[model samples]
Target: DIDPELKQTYDVMNRLRETIKNRDWPNYNQAFHPLQGCSEEMLAALQTLAAHHDEIGNTFTHHYTNGPLEGSNNKIKVIKRTGFGYRNFFRFRLRVLFAFRVHTKRALITK
Candidate 1:
């Protein structure tokens, strides 16, 4: 289990769904909603967060800030490194395609 403070932080974040519901903020950073991806669910969650902000009177809300894309990019770099000595363009293309397929499929299933 996570620590109480960590859980509290998470709870606070969940509460921010309401905070973002009512405002016309241009950016999620102002409300600290890091998980506000460009998805419908994220937009809805932001709307909820805005509404909650007004209810609770808390000005500063927070969320999961960073994306895993950078990590995935790093992994791709590693894969490229592993294929560094490939002489044929076709082999390189195959390696990259296979890596992308494996990574994206795993990410989708995990999500």
Candidate 2:
């Protein structure tokens, strides 16, 4: 079995994660209010989480995310690195745009 302290810490953190995911403030407060003398690492983490409580709450309140935008940026950066052989800057730009702008499926024609 894990050390009791470690197990307690894990239980507390797991409860915290579930409360955050569910946006249950009452449960979160119950789980978080007793962090007085946990291990030093947990204390530090608690401080960080306390400082960002509003931001963390905001995170759970919104379903929107910048994940897709970050993915697109990563794709563009990779293309930029490997596209040096393009004849010109505009041509390279076009290639990148085409990669993103092209339709995966053609439209049906019914005349």
Candidate 3:
């Protein structure tokens, strides 16, 4: 059998996941407060989360994320890696532009 403390820790983590998944902002404090004494690592994480409580809670209020920008960044990384890096910044910029232009054209054609 697992240790009692470890089981409790798992329970807390599961509850926290459920709280976030359900966007239960009002019960966030109740869910998180118990972690302050769960373990040193959990306590430290709790402190950090408390510090950014507003931002964390904002996820429930806002339905947007930086997904598109992150996707673009990933694409740029792939381009840079595949080309083995570029010596000229202007050429790199043009390549990035060209890549996106081709992507857009292909998307339009497929539609």
Candidate 4:
């Protein structure tokens, strides 16, 4: 038997999928209409996006979360204190990117 939480998530996913499959256009403030004739193509694209969403969501949940990024920002503050602050935001950004490239690459590989 599926857990209650998983069942709820599946229901929500199905609703969203149906909405995408049926919607005439990406409009706002109206109920989405079923595309009617293009169900196959619509559903195929939607299913592909859903699968990618699940993959990315799983990666975000299991690794490379915002927690570590925030922690590194805190650590950067300490580094700034010692280095008398990085006045060039671009250089600072590159430094951070370079430092984290290995970890990000590993995460992408594992994912």
**Highest TM-score against the true fold, candidate:** 2
Query: Backbone clashes per model, in order?
Result: 20, 0, 0, 0
Clashing pairs in 2: none
The top-ranked prediction according to lDDT is 3
Instruction: Give per-residue CA lDDT, model 4, range 69-101, as digits (tens).
Output: 788888777666766778876666556566566
Candidate 3 Cα misplacement greater than 4 A, ranges: 85-98, 101-111
Worst 10 residues of 1 by lDDT: 56-65
* TM-score of predicted structure 4: 0.27
- Rank by TM-score, highest first: 2, 3, 1, 4
State in Å the error of residue 103, model 2: 5.3
Evaluation by TM-score, superior candidate among 2 and 4: 2
Q: Please give the lDDT score for candidate 4.
A: 0.53
Q: lDDT value for candidate 3?
A: 0.78
Q: Which parts of model 4 have CA positions greater than 4 angstroms off?
A: 1-67, 102-111
For residues 1-111, could you state the per-residue lDDT of candidate 2 as single tens digits? Answer: 457777767777898989987888778878887664467788788889889988877776777888999999999888988876776766676667677985433321111
Q: Is candidate 1 or candidate 2 better by TM-score?
A: 2
- The worst-scoring run of ten residues by lDDT in candidate 3 lies at 102-111
List TM-score per model, in order: 0.29, 0.75, 0.69, 0.27
Off by over 4 Å in 2: 1-3, 85-87, 103-111
